[model samples]
Target: MNTRLLFFLLIICPLSAVCQTFTSSNLPILVIDTRGGTILDDPKIVADLRIIDNGPGKRNNLTDKASFTSVMGIEYRGATSQQFFPKKPYGIELRDSTGINSVAKSVLGMPAESDWVLNATYNDKTLIRETLTYDFYRKMSKYYASRFRYCELVLNGEYRGIYIVMERLKRDKNRVPITSIKKTDITGDAVTGGYILKIDKTVGSTSRSWKSPYPSGPRNINLDIQIDRPKPEDLAEEQFQYIKKYVSDFEASLAGSDFRDPTKGFRAFVDEQSFIDYLILTEVCKNVDGYRLSAYFYKERDSKGGKITMGPIWDYNLTYGNADYCEGNSYMGWAFNFSRVCPKDDFVLPFWWDRLLLDLDFARKVKEKYKALRQTVLTPERLGAFVDSTSSALTESRQRNFVKWPVIGTYVWPNGFVGRTYEAETDYLKTWIGQRLTWMDINIESFGVLTALREEAAFTLGPNPSIGDVTLKLPLPTPTDVSLSLTDMQGRALQTRHWPAQPKGLFERTLPATDFNTGPGVYILTISTQTGPTSRVIVRE
Candidate 1:
């Protein structure tokens, strides 16, 4: 066959690329030869310090005056029959209320059993839903490392450990300097701590390939964070103290509390989209002999499924000092549904409004507890000694360490993370974590431009479903000359009025839209400002 004809045949066939490159899936390789390298880049294992020293790796976590530690025991078996690298003990150090290695190893470490992989693949466009599985954790980890690498080495003339970072994807990269993240090697779900999914060299031609639980997890344009899968007992403790929802018989626009009960809220803690997604996904499932494997979901076979509850209550890691990373690195508190794109489907807005302040209250309490735990782990004298002890371990064991925050900024609020410089170095974990938890402050929206302008556009002119007696409230974020007008779908003006002193702050007034030359189906109330006209909908029933 000619070159053109051969190319055409290849186009009609699948696996042509893989077939040309590899004898089988077991031994496939990429051009960069990044394979065979350890993700952690340990100096002892790699030999050359520079290989482990691209820059530095860093960790940050949220903290506050009241924070406390919720340490669990880290158990070490030393060696295990199961194939995994982090074989010794980590939970010991984390759960140890005492900072000392001797106490932590005995108290925190517990015997861990089997490790398993949950493999998944998507051709494309899990779209918005995939953002959770793919983007959030990767960016958060990278940004945390970036900020950490550039942190001051000698905080007030004291030694901080060598830290390295590796956040590799652009989608996870934050643009704003205030966001304190930097570029780093980011991996996905499949990489379980320091384990590999397959071995290419030793397997050779006969070598078969299999997935690694952690490594294979984020193999595509993927994202992963080390999340200890929830145990059955752990799931039982995950319920919220209270969950309330509003079931409005009235239209979404009709704002009133007549139907709202004082004590209990609506029956479900679910939003409309979540409920819809839930209902759709449930019906589409195929029933099998004993199990209904909801596994093959993305088969465009059907776009249906039930609602998946958002999470397992993240953002409290610093409340326990389990990880040395900060929240701003990932901004996990927000951005779950950016790919979802619909105003109605994006639930974070309401979720944030509902939970931010509540999280802060809980965070403050947790913050206090973590601090006291830290003190128990370290004395004023031992604080220095503790730092000295861990410095060598970091350099020997890990790569991508850093000592700075990423580069993004939010509105400068009081008691926030951003300033021209760092005020307290040792307190990095505490202050940094505090600013992160504050992002959920529902009042955060109140301090923003979107809220100000939207509030100015609010009013309730109704007597039951009947409409009239419309009132104007103007408190736009920016000042501009303004005018009010009502318009029908065909661009015909029903009523127009000019306001002379629109003012910088608040303004409210009653309007006469009933007299306009029009019949009522639906009309728009338009507030024309020097910047632009802000519009809201009105019904003529």
Candidate 2:
């Protein structure tokens, strides 16, 4: 359970999400979590953890970013300020109950905890001091280091500059794929089993100790950043469906034992939105287990006709929270967000521009989706009660008074249940919703390219294995020399035809496939010309 909790906590942490640091260096708890089920006395871990191990004698364990992965992949390294971190560590345990303690002390230049929240310079300092409050945790063993952040995502929804990337573990190096067979048939079920076995994948050592805020030296954590390239927008659509399933499973898991629905965690607090709010949230924010995992389709070239569909699910880590990380993506933090993919002031794609241009569409349609889903997934009663309880729990989690979070003072919960959320804090944030709505006015446009030539090269293919000829709908830009090569999935060229590229318009071609021994399988059609290249897939019986 500790291992699973640790893994999930690491996946959800947002502060150091930018580093994608899955290093075993700073998180010494992972070191002590020898048994798979040990619960953490978290306060102890935060106070003692250090990024550098620096053997007892040399005490300088550092790693740098210059040695950052040559290729963009998931690997963790230790560095500070974009440089590898090589420093000695503080040893032995002290009885200091104050959160201001650490082994990376010298690294942080021993500044008072007051001077260091996000920025602290410690060159002559002896060690780096770390801090934590009880509100950060969900259970005594787990914390929201993955979700909550001191950084405000939206200063009134005007894009407060934040970007969050969730780091979920994918297949292990020795993982095997189960491509046994395919079932084209379909019988609709409320819950169609996912083709991908996500939750079942085992968790093991593929990450380091402190996989947060990189600069993890001597920590063999792979920091993978190059997300799968974008496929056709349709591909993105398919991924949306896949994640819709994942969310269902996660919600069901909440019903599992040992889980707390957001509302009943610690104390009673009102959720600003109704059951409708939760529903709309789950609908638009289709968070799949693999939303953070980089899968094969991210780069697979097997597009039969549609583009690959997945996601950059960039604003994650704040799972089940209201703070944005780097890219002010307040899209779902209990408030309306204009656009995270594209700021209104910047030139963006037409589709997202559709969201920016018509904020009302997102607000209304999303509101409707929320309303419908709320009826089914989260009942109004369930949410109404939860709002009061969780809000109370949030108010109670405040303890061990830190100046930064003065809201923190002597607080206790009933039988381990803590109230969360400062009522005033929630209200302060809500008032900005209007300003955020106004901030979506960023200019959305791009520079047009005037190349040496111009024409619309759109085409369509159909009626494979026809007794007659195949008609290909083509929109050519100019009448130039064009060659068409037909092939199979194995790249075996089947036929070639030569023709002239027609003017920027649609044309048709009828070809006979009577010579090829094509059965019920996949085939490819490639049209090449001086303008560019286009390919399509064909299925024959």
lDDT per residue (tens digit) for residues 104-190 in model 1: 121011122111111110111110112221222232222111111111111111122121111111111131111111112012211
In order of listing, the candidates' clash counts read 101, 90
The local lDDT score (0 to 100) that residue 335 gets in candidate 1 is 23
In order, candidate lDDTs are 0.25, 0.27
lDDT of 1: 0.25
Model 2 misplaced regions, further than 4 Å: 1-307, 310-369, 378-397, 401-421, 426-541
Q: Which ten contiguous residues of candidate 1 have the minimum total lDDT? A: 284-293
Residue 195 of model 1 has an lDDT of 11
Q: How accurate locally is residue 306 in candidate 1, as Cα lDDT from 0 to 100?
A: 16
Task: Give stretches of model 1 more than 4 Å off.
Answer: 1-264, 267-311, 314-395, 400-536, 539-541
